[model samples]
Target: MAASLCYMNPTMIVTTSHRSSAELWRQAEEWAQRIGARAVRRQGSLAHLCELHEADGVLTITNDRLVYREPASGLEYFFHPGMAKVRIHNIEVGRGDPMIGAMQLRPGDGLLDCTVGRASDAVVAAYVAGPQGHILGLEKVPVIAQLTIHGLATYEDSSRKVTQLLRRIEVVQADYNDYLPACADDSFDTVYFDPVFHEPVEKSEPMKPLRELADKATVTAGALQQALRVARRSVVIKQRYGTPLWDQLGITQVLSSRSSRIEYGIAEP
Candidate 1:
């Protein structure tokens, strides 16, 4: 459930902030080269820069964070823990998380996140899995992957425990469809997918930008088969409550949250 790299979009360009220093400029150029995109000097507003370069969007590297701006939508995407921090706090207070419950995660467990858009769920999973556990997230889009990689490495939460959990996650730029087949059977304790919901959640403002950038592909039968094979404990898929996806995938065991509209469909290998 991932798209091709951002470099696949020829209209994308990388640039430094308007007031960037020499080191930041150099870093921007390096990132541009790594992503196979043009590195342009910041001349004016992000929209003006996009217009000048005839690009769809601009990825601006600043001292604080990496920001991607889509001129048409005026949507800026940057990496933030978002709800993962809140979810982790809830867990710390004895208020359990639905995803943790669905996975029945244990210390030392390994989790493979198939569609790790922004990696909020992955962070939460890593926290529950503890120091002995390992979390690997797969994101096909190069820009999203890079943003997440940088954020997980650099972002520091007020809680040192949260920061440690974030650092434990490893982000890889690869589509799950291709990555899954390469992994050996029973390689991970749990394989998870959180594809962009077929029906959007109106109140999810943060998700709007992600949905625009992320691959919209639904979980395919073949991919589910691979997930089941690769998972030793369970494969959990996040979808809207009453989604036809569960029936379509022949998933009968599902965990629901009374307060939320989402459900986790679970299948054992």
Candidate 2:
């Protein structure tokens, strides 16, 4: 269970949106009851806002979806239309792009996303692979996994394709370093990793909160070797251009873009 895997904020309050329909508040209270979180009226001086410094965060249920507001971080996290990575994938798809050509995924390919942060890549993979394919995402941090799941479930988009893609992914809370090694040989058509970059860069507001909750586990040589063994075709690693993680893993074949700072390293099995 997620509770056993990682302890979430015990003081996290489930509250309604400041301005929302009455149904939204009812849903929020029911959700709060289900999650064992305190649900209070949206009036002033609620315990959640009162204990601002003492509380870890506030999980606010708006008419659309769940939003996590962290006062200490001064950041709000929720799923919306303007995710940068997903926009990049959409643009590339329009161009018939092959940023990670070696993946060679078809409609029936099975993919394992080692680090499914924001699940942008997983969404793209599922879109290309279609309903017949399998897409499994492993997230070490249970809180982030739960947040992503909620976003996927609650957010309604005008694009039916996007909504379907989001629904296709299966997310699990597990350390990939342990899970990857246990998988049988040739278990998946592609195994991919996009670990947080080792270098420090200016982050956007959304990334700031994510960085706080991300798994700090480094991708080791042994784990890379295991990924290669488990993958039937190729293993891809996404990282910032010229990241030392590539050198550490000795990844030679790379696909890059002069237009952007991100790059993908490919390892064929």
Regions of candidate 2 where Cα sits further than 4 Å from its true position: 1-13, 17-53, 81-94, 98-102, 200-206
Predict model 2's lDDT versus the native: 0.72
Lowest summed-lDDT stretch of 10 residues in model 2? Answer: 1-10
Instruction: State how far residue 128 of model 1 sits from its true place (Å).
Output: 0.9
Q: What clash pairs does model 1 have?
A: none
Candidate 2 is scored at a TM of 0.78
lDDT of 1 by residue, 90-189 (tens): 9889998999999999889999999887889999999888889999999877778888888899998888987898899999988898999999999999
Poorly placed runs, candidate 1 (over 4 Å): 1-10
For residues 149-260, could you state the per-residue lDDT of candidate 2 as single tens digits? Answer: 7666655567777887788888886788779878999999999987777663454455666666576556777878999999999998877777777788898988876456
Model 1 TM: 0.94
Q: Which candidate is the best by TM-score?
A: 1
Full-model lDDT, candidate 1: 0.87
Local error of candidate 2 at 183, Å?
Answer: 2.2
